[model samples]
Target chain A: MSEPIVVIRGVEKWFGGLRALGPVDVDLKPGERLGLIGPNGSGKTTLINCLSGLFVPDKGTIVYDGRDITREPAFRRARMGIARSFQIPRPFTGMTVLENLLVPMDYLGSHERSELERADEVLASVGLAARRDAPAESLSQLELRKLELARALVTEPKVLVADEAMAGLSENEIDDVLALLMRLNDTGVAIIMIEHIMHAVMRFSQRMICLETGRIIAMGTPQDVAQDRQVQKVYFGERAGA
Target chain B: MRTLPFLVIAALILVGGLFLPQFVGNPYYFFAGYVVLQYVVIATGWNILGGYAGYINFGTSAFFGAGVYVAAFLIKAFGAPLPVQILAAGVVGMLLGVATGYLTLRIQGVYFSIATVALVVVLETLIHNIDYLGGASGMQTIAPPAPAWFGGQTQYVFCAMLVLAVVAVVAARFIERSWIGRSLRAIKASEPAAEACGVPTLSMKLVACAISGAIIAIAGAPYAYYASHVDPLSAFSLTIGLNALAMPLIGGTRSWIGPVIGALLLASVQQIATVTISSEFNILAVGIVLIAFVVLAPEGILGLIADLKEKLRRRGARP
Candidate 1:
């Protein structure tokens, strides 16, 4: 592959005395679809948090587009085109859906286009055009997830770290979101998807990384990582110790 | 409303208000109007941070007291005029705001509020010890001669306050309708989400704190001249902080008009209560009205009005 868009080296995070994540390394190429899968408490969110500039790594450096961004604040990182969706929907309260999109557009978007048109386009792309004027608090589960994705997409980010964007979504809703992500990937934006759903991620990702207790247990193509002994053991509990 | 038309209307109304002392023979009206207008400025300033950004500032007295002292010092040392004192107070209050925000904003919620309260106590004690600013005792300040057209010091000061109120309201309104206002709302709603959207939450909060402090201190700058005395007990009065918070809540915290309405309604009630009944009833009135509004109309009069309008519209549509 050509020069990677993001290079993370030896990133580690500690909460008090407990080590939450890493000594992990990851490289994401331009327009790449990377799947990050792990069970609960496996530090998937923690790793993404570090990558998105929420937590400064206790050790290691992150270089984004060849600039050292390990110590950058979250907003600066976002302005630098790295955007993330929260695991939980965090729609700005007391605002309309269109106003919600206007916020990021106001702060980080290109001023070449009218902000309303850009916001409306993103809303339509996510199938939320009908609900554009609706209050964020009034959205349903699927709509909230779509809003989360739409918000991330509104930034027109180079790297979109979607943390459980498909959780609590219906099966049909899952395919809809999956198609949205695929379409976005086709537009030359790299995506790091953190999901608990196996088949959906396996289908979306060209490469996969399985994390267990903050360390990578497997990294390969979908079929290869799925059948890996270590990944299978982590998923199925080693078949009762053989 | 568009910026130009809103400004034009506000200017006309404020200029008309400046002529009020000419019509009313009673000097008490100007005296009372000064206090109400001062509250308008304070409540407007308070809402910029408290209502919009959701940062409760118990240090209203701290900034106000600082302005009172700053103006007193200028008056005593340089015999500076009201405008100069106000300008100086704004600068000092802004610095204090930046310092306080830097120190306390890292701690969220009630912890931040407690720190602001602590700031009040700390500043109060520091002011009490400073002999130059009259220490535990108070200093009397004499006002410069009022202009001929204004008639008296009270009327002139009332005009000055009316101007400041307009400025404060316009500033608050501008912030509400601007990008900064949207960013502050985002910070209030969710800091992490705002930051992820490239809002720079900490810096935006500091901006709110600075502007809020400067405007509040501007309200206080003329107080020494108005009251004719600056003392720790009165300058750092508990009532100022209470009313600063209560006025915004009673008006509506969501928009610029809310605080203005709140200040006008609450301050007028207190003034009338002081006139008709015992002066002690001022706080009592505030307490009763505040509790009623909190219970029955938690969103304040503006919210109530909006709900009423919505219901009326729905009814009309049904017909």
Candidate 2:
């Protein structure tokens, strides 16, 4: 296999006296669908934040595309083709849907196509063409999630970290988003889906890792990880009881 | 190419202003016109950072006062021309803006605003201690004689302010339509999201600050020449800061025209109130209008107009 597109080695993070994530290592390959699963406060978001350059690891190096980018700023990482959607959708308020996509496109200075055409295309791809001129504040919950995905897609990113992209979504809506992400993956984009929904993540990931107390308890194919005793006891067992 | 219309409007306004002194015999009209135009610059400047980026700066007077002092120093030291004084003031204002934005913007939101307010106090104290620029007292300025083409000094200053107002509006409009404006709006909506989307939020904010600071200070440079006096109290008056904030909020913060409209309406009303009711009543009236706008129409007059149009369209469609 080719060298991994992203290599995280010995990455750890601490918030004050509390250790939130790490002493963990992971690798993502090109065009891979990686599911990152963890319980509440189990460091899934923390790990993604580290990967996306929101927080520098207290220790360890994050090499992306063969270069150490552990110290890079979030914006620089974004321009270097690392894009993410917030767990909570943040639509640029007071702006039209088309304008929201235009923001990132304009900043990245990509003009392969006219901005208006590109914006229209993205909006269409996300099934939001009908609402292109609508104010972002006027979007439905499902539409907002689609917008979040579209905003990340506008950069033509190599790695897309979708943080809880399906949380609070109905089962059908989850499937809709899953299908959209799968379609994106078919175009050769690597996606790191950080999710709490087990069935969806299990169905989506070719490889999955379960995080607990800031450490990876299981990492393997979806079936193997699901069948792992520790993953069941620490993740599924608790959910089954609840 | 898109700016052609704005340029044309600016030229037309300039031509119209040049012919103003020919008709208006009263020097008071020019004086009032200068004050209104000055606020036009201030409001437009404030909106660049405050409206576009959602960074509320309470230190408007600090930049304004810095320009006044810069002009005072230039007049005292080298007897610089009005253009030179204005240019120097712009540089100083831009520097202060960049410095302050660099130091405080990292804190974010209300804390950033408080830091800006503190900046005013620090600069005001610094000016108060400087003996050369008339420390506790103020400096008296005798402006150079007006050029032969302009009938008088007031008309010249009025024309100067008109030019500044035009320039400020044009700059604001350009920014609103540019990539910088879109990035600022994104930053305003969500800084983290904007960063993740590839906007250098801090750098864009600093640029906004520098441009805003320079324009506001440019407004103050002419003030020193117009009033023919430089006092720290009047220069850094809370009213100027309040007006700077209020005008943009009242007119609408979405586009460049909002602040211009707000400043024109509010400044004109204040001018009338000062003459008819009393100077004290002028402040009270502004306070009342601002409160009413904030409560009844947070989007300001432009927003109110848009809402009304939407309502009219809906009604027409129903019929």
Candidate 3:
């Protein structure tokens, strides 16, 4: 189609000579549901971190919306409409769920409708209107994930990278999140779902990629990647070889 | 909304200062009262960074000491007016705050606190060794200005600043009620989440530091003039740091007015204890209160009021 919305070429990150992830390249298009699946320490998170500007890549350039954001700070990337959810949901403890949505809205600095109204609508859209005033620490795990998504969505981001949003979630909860993300995809927001859960990810993602030891071993349709020799060996090795 | 008692108490202290000779008639209490106000300023400032942002800074005395040395130098050399001296001190403190924010904000855990403590030691050693800014001998023979207005009177200056403090409290209260205040509270609660949601955590923290440093420094100028002189030891000493932390903890870090209340009440009690019991016991006494309150009343006296209100509400609803 047209140029990809996100292009990562020759990206590499190392922690003290340990290449946690890279020399990797990937492209994400507008309104695409991309599933990034990897075993533990497969560099999925690292790649996401580099893309979100959490850590500067040791090498390679990350182009988003036709500009190189390789050296941008996390906040600047957010301002440019790039957002991500943490692997561990970090709802601000002691703040209401509604307030969690409102904090990021302040970054917009007097844009669009009233700030409070904007926060309220975001909360409602996430199915957290009833729990808006509740302390974040008190939220159920699923609710926390929803609040996390609402926060990323509040920036009106073009790309929302959800890191392990389905981790530790029940099967039904996983389905719930899948549906929620699908709804957003329908609204033209590209979502990069980094997950370990196979069935849910397979059902949700239009395309799936498998990462092993910081390198992409497989990238194709769910069935293709799942049936790939290396992917099957890695999962089989974990069960019997380990 | 929770700051009413504090506003009233601060007013009462000012009124009490008016008729000091008729009541306790002790200059020592006035001295202590002045110290309390100064501590309120420090505690409030430290609370912005330490209490609100959860960045514990042990180098408050460094900024306070900067205000002390600069104010003393201006008065000693050029004979600057109190207002001018105070204004200069505030600007210096704000600048120092910016520098500290830049240097230490990136650090997490004990490293941040250590950086601040190290800053204090660095500044203190510089003052102790250097000949200018009073060195070891310290500035002496300072004459506390009576100010020309109100006919060279303490009452006039006191009234004006007391009015100013009231205005400051009001503005602080208004901020507490508004959007910026809520954002600070959010950032304080969880910085990463706040940032992800679009709160500018770094800038919010820097602004807190700037506002905090400026106010604490402004509070110092009057005290520097009141004491008539300041040495490196008295100005940069851990006493101000201890008092600052203590007042906020004792009053409860929950509300904006908490530190102010803690400063006045705790300062008054210590003054009376020093006179009636013994001078040496004063330090021991406040230290005890600091430890005891944090351990026993972690919520502070204000939190107690909230509990009492809840109990009363429950009782009224009983069948």
- Winner on DockQ between 1 and 2 is 2
lDDT of 3 by residue, A161-236 (tens): 9999988999888888888899888999999999888788888889988888988899999889888888888754
Candidate 2 lDDT, B44-119, residue by residue in tens? 9999999999999899999999998898888888888899999999999999999999999899999999998998
Candidate number with greatest DockQ: 2
Chain B only, TM-score of each candidate: 0.97, 0.97, 0.86
The DockQ value obtained for model 1 is 0.80
Model 1, B197-309: lDDT tens digits are 98998999999999999999999999888888899888888899999999999999989999999999999999998988978999988999999999999999999998999
TM-scores of the candidates are 0.96, 0.97, 0.91
Off by over 4 Å in 1: A109-113, A238-242
For all candidates, what are the clash counts?
A: 0, 0, 2
- C-alpha lDDT score of every prediction, in listed order: 0.91, 0.92, 0.78
Candidate 3's displacement at residue B37, Å, is 1.3
Between prediction 2 and prediction 3, the one with superior DockQ is: 2
Better of 2 and 3 by lDDT: 2
- The DockQ figures for the candidates are 0.80, 0.85, 0.52
* Candidate 3 backbone collisions, by pair: A104-B197, A104-B198
Q: Please tell me which model should have the higher lDDT, number 1 or number 2.
A: 2
**Weakest 10 consecutive residues, lDDT, candidate 2 chain A?**
A107-116
